[model samples]
Target: MVRLRVLFASCWCFVAAASFSQGDTSLIRAAVLEQWVRALSHDSMQGRMSGSSGAQKAALWIATAFRQIKLKPLSPKKSMILPATVETGRLRVRINNVVGVIPGTDPSAPAVYFTAHYDHVGVGSAFSESFPKFAPFHKKTDKDSIFNGANDNASGIAGLLSLARYFFSAPRLPNTLVFAAFDGEEFDNLGSSAYVGQQEPGKVKLVLNLEMLGRARMDSSLGHFPIVTYSRDDKWVIDSLNKYYRIAFGDTSRTKYFLPDPYPERQLYERSDNYIFALEGIPANGIMMTNDQDLYYHHPADEWQTLDYGLMELVLRRIALTVYQWLKASGGS
Candidate 1:
């Protein structure tokens, strides 16, 4: 194990020297990212289906990480997890949204949010489709269905937590920052919908949602730059991203990729948690490694082992840096 660690570090050094003259590859920890993804995606969480005991457990784990990172809870109750009820079809269940806040030095400043959902479709039922035959990774008569959502959103959770920890311990920014782990997103973005419904329009300056930050498409290599979709009217968000990204990395050759939803007619913008904020006239955007076309999406086959730690680290570090620069440029001291 020691030798492997040494070899890994050496390889990273070689790669860094070869490619990133201006990038800071050491800003984020690969081991920490790996640990979060592994624990969240473990079968013990039972796919982290919304409103299930498994989802509750996952919420607890996220709250613990927030506390350990020293982020103050945003709720008036002094709690990190906010409870909610979600109804899909005829089924209704209670769930949680884990929230942490860093009130800016200037409390009057606009707030910026970072969000990710930690829920997935639950296991198959007795009358549901055939087990392993239908799902390809399940058993013939498996009593408990495990749709361990590794890439679907576990990777997003890891990114959220890591960013919280990174910013909490660093120099204070000017604008307030909120980190949220939403529940019941799979059930029509219920978690985020509730959050946006309660907030006053324009109370938030920006919303940066992270989802499926794990794997790329089968034809693409791991960490192949993911998509960053923004609100139609929010050109400032994209401009800030590209501007600060260049400022932070000193790499003008590769601009931060931000695009409007190419298929607005498809309502693709409304598909994720960010949509709720967008509907409320708040400038919102999100990061996604892949869309619904990915083969492992929502499949039991999505596991921690399938992700590339090197890519995860790089992408997450870039996100942290880019966000920092954006907030700083927005007047975060």
Candidate 2:
């Protein structure tokens, strides 16, 4: 782990220096990010619980973003919503995954995916009803309860929308780029599981799932860096990222904003959409900034105001740079 951190640090230095000289001026706007997060995390969205009206609304909003970006739908249909039925115990619920694509110059090239789960645990069920663990922190109130999940995933979805816009503006790409906003992730990872199972064989090159990117971990003094978690054998993912950073910045070193997952024991790598793809032997990974012990995690307090828009803007810009260059290096137009 120490060795990997050192490698990443050295590469980041190279990329940073190169970026300054190369004039990579495209930056993620703070207002754009804040708007998306606020819309998704608003009270009317009802925590965006899968199968609920609010979730459907959120899915439609994402589809609108894709349409505005001019991303082609993955299927023959013009619509971006892929609906599925998820079973929980004896109950059945409908969910949707908003999927879009940018066809690559090379038809046979393995596609790269950018994914983020758009669902969250809903409101009303509190300590006395479902989650006893939350009883100590939350107080019973006359007001209605809702878990807005601004950081838990709204921020990730915001990032996905901005990335779609960023890549759509590019002239050419190497390989096909698939953007998936998954639903029902909070309920046993059903959305991503179904999507992965239905894909054509050998079509996936890599999966980069985004989650909880709004706030930095309070435990770290340098808090804003993201944790990039990949499977044990998927070191090539890092190498490819480094390759892109070098190509974009005209530098020989890797990028610095990512660090290996620090709390592997938490099993965070297997806890998101990328895990399903990784299970199928694809080079899958997730980038996020979440700590289970975070005071606001899953609580009603995880609202838009609690988010750090400045940090989100910086992170989104870094992600856009890396992804755009990665596509070029991997054969994207």
Please tell me which predicted candidate would have the highest lDDT against the true structure: 2
Candidate 1 regions exceeding 4 Å error are 1-27, 126-144, 198-202, 217-227, 254-256, 259-266
TM-score of each: 0.82, 0.83
Query: For model 1, how does the per-residue alpha-carbon lDDT over 163-210 read when each residue is reduced to its tens digit?
Result: 887787556777789998999887789888776655443467889898
User: Which pairs of residues have clashing backbones in candidate 1?
Assistant: 174-332
lDDT of each: 0.75, 0.77
Instruction: List the lowest-lDDT window of 10 residues for candidate 2.
Output: 126-135
